[model samples]
Target: MSTIAKEIESTMELNPGIPIKVLQDLIQKKYQVHISLKKIFRAKVLATKKVQSDFTTQYLLLRDYCAELLRSNRDTTVTIEVEREFNPTTESRQFKRIYICYGCLKVGFKQRGGEVLGLDGCFMKGPFPRQILTAVGVYGNNGIYPVAFAIVEAESSSSWTWFLQCLGNDLDLNIRSNFTFLSDRKKGIIPAIKKVYPSIEHRYCPRHIHENMKIKWRSNMFKNMLWKAGGQSVMDYSTMYDMAANGIEGGIPESWVDEVYWLSTWKKVNENTIDPINGKEMWTPSACPTSLLPPEHHTQIGRPKKARKKSVEELSQKINTGGKMTRKGKAVTCQVCKQKGHNKRGCKERGPSTSTQPTSQQQ
Candidate 1:
């Protein structure tokens, strides 16, 4: 194992998703030694552990992070809830949900106010995938200004209720607040909104309307026309009242990952003890009441999917490249010629023919 330690390390860095069987074969060919698959697997596990914090550590750190958020930024609301289980003095409680509304963003949203608030949630990808709900406000200049966000077990009515409750408390939103909420027809959101702010106006997003239409009528020309006909701009959530009704198991992700979702990563509490607002070291007391155990790992059935499902138009525009996920509705470009409509294999150059002048010789 020591002889090929560097080999495995480099390979893992280059392509972490390389199959274990393939790695085993490569080792045999290169090092001329046979190592058990179990041993190889163990090495890979140790390497991953070294790179990323496990679920337990991140969960433990979440408590301290909340403390720092409050300390550095005054009036910023950060709430965390965990399940109360029957355990000894040793075990940590399982995480239920967390809501964060930065003081700067909250104030900014209020000052540069708009009546409309956009709410949406997307799936967080990884070993212990969960839903992340967000409430985004529009800037006076018509840009997206995020007001608050929350990470919850699922995108359900109960979760939405809890999240909205927290948000209402911070923003002073009530039954008479009269703010317009723009959102999609998620299963739980309507009831949740009605329960929290019954009198407020609820609006449906045009993009979401188009998406719903796509499910029934799959047409590219229709998609283009819909966008051109109804050009629109974006999307809005809450925290805790109860957990008795929902029976979700608790713990969190087994590994650290990703760079694509910069906002997601930033919100995930990037390796930081420093507070972003005040630029101070965010610290927690030596001892505390809340001990959050990571959400429980739920092994999903079937192959895990990282990419989001594409609409019919997106699938139609893209040609299948053996086992590779295609970008949504993006034209394929050739690597060799950097031209659209063809891939590297079929790339070619075409230019206008030059005219031959035989006038001098003929004359």
Candidate 2:
């Protein structure tokens, strides 16, 4: 192990994910002797610890790190909530959730931002697998402006509720905020938003809705219907009703609309309007608490995914990197049903008999 560690000690920092098989080959070339794949794996683990240290030690530093944010940036929020269980053997707490909203982001939102806020959560892949919930506002420049984010145990209703509540408290959410949420309609997020901001308008992402539609309907007509709601507004609806309902500022004189939609409004560009908070800060706790145990990740069957599963629409989109073309909106066709976007078990049209037909052997 020591010999193997010395061989790839430098490689760990440069590329931690370098495969064990690669390391085994490298060691063989360097030392002119063959090493087992299992020993190479053990050496890689040791080198990882030497480089990054134990993850549990990192969790211990979060309290002081959070304190630094509060000190350097006024009106910043850093909440750390732990689970109820305490191991007497280790004197450690189970980390439940932590929400962070830097003051700079809040200032940006307050000074100039659109009414629309996008919320989403995804799995945080690591030893301690959790969920990261994020809320970003539509910037004056139409860019994604980060507002707040939280790391929680799971992306469930309770966790979402907690994250939203923390966000609401920081943003001081109310009727005046007039914030419209746009989400992909994840299972728990809808209920959580409704609970936190009951009066606020919730909108769905057309792309995500279309992805769901692809599972059931695969025709070209089905795809076009997804985009029917959008486009130039026609003169069909009562002008008064259109003004009051569909648009934020319907058929307005260009000058009457808020400068948020205007690109030429540059008067405030020179000014330090909201005095955005400093993100770089350091704090050293004189006496820090006991380090929390590294959340044990039980080995699960099957290979773990590094990249997120993309929808057919996302996958079908042409890559601009090298100008590669793709067959747009195509998905996996179920062998049983001959439908796109699903496998045999997931095929709604395929019954048990029909599903088994593919695997049946001729007598």
**All candidates' lDDT scores?**
0.71, 0.72
What's model 2's TM-score? 0.67
**lDDT, model 2, position 319:** 66
Candidate 2: the clashing residue pairs are none
Stretches off by above 4 angstroms in model 1 are 1-36, 45-53, 86-91, 228-282, 299-307, 316-363
Residue 112 lDDT in model 2? 62
RMSD value for candidate 2: 10.9
Model 1, 1-363: lDDT tens per residue? 454444676666545566788888998898798889987887777655442345467777777777777778777898887766776675567887899998777765665445678999986644355689999976433467688899988888999999999988988898889799999998789999999999999988878888889877777778788877666422100111122236433223212222322344333332223346432253754256657777775543347555667865555775767888678667898887888988876756644546696556655
Task: Give me the candidate number with maximum TM-score.
Answer: 2
- Residue 85, model 1, lDDT: 75
Q: State which candidate has the highest lDDT.
A: 2
The residue ranges of model 2 lying beyond 4 angstroms of the native Cα positions read 3-34, 45-52, 86-91, 174-177, 219-221, 231-256, 263-282, 286-293, 298-308, 314-363
User: How does candidate 1 score on lDDT?
Assistant: 0.71
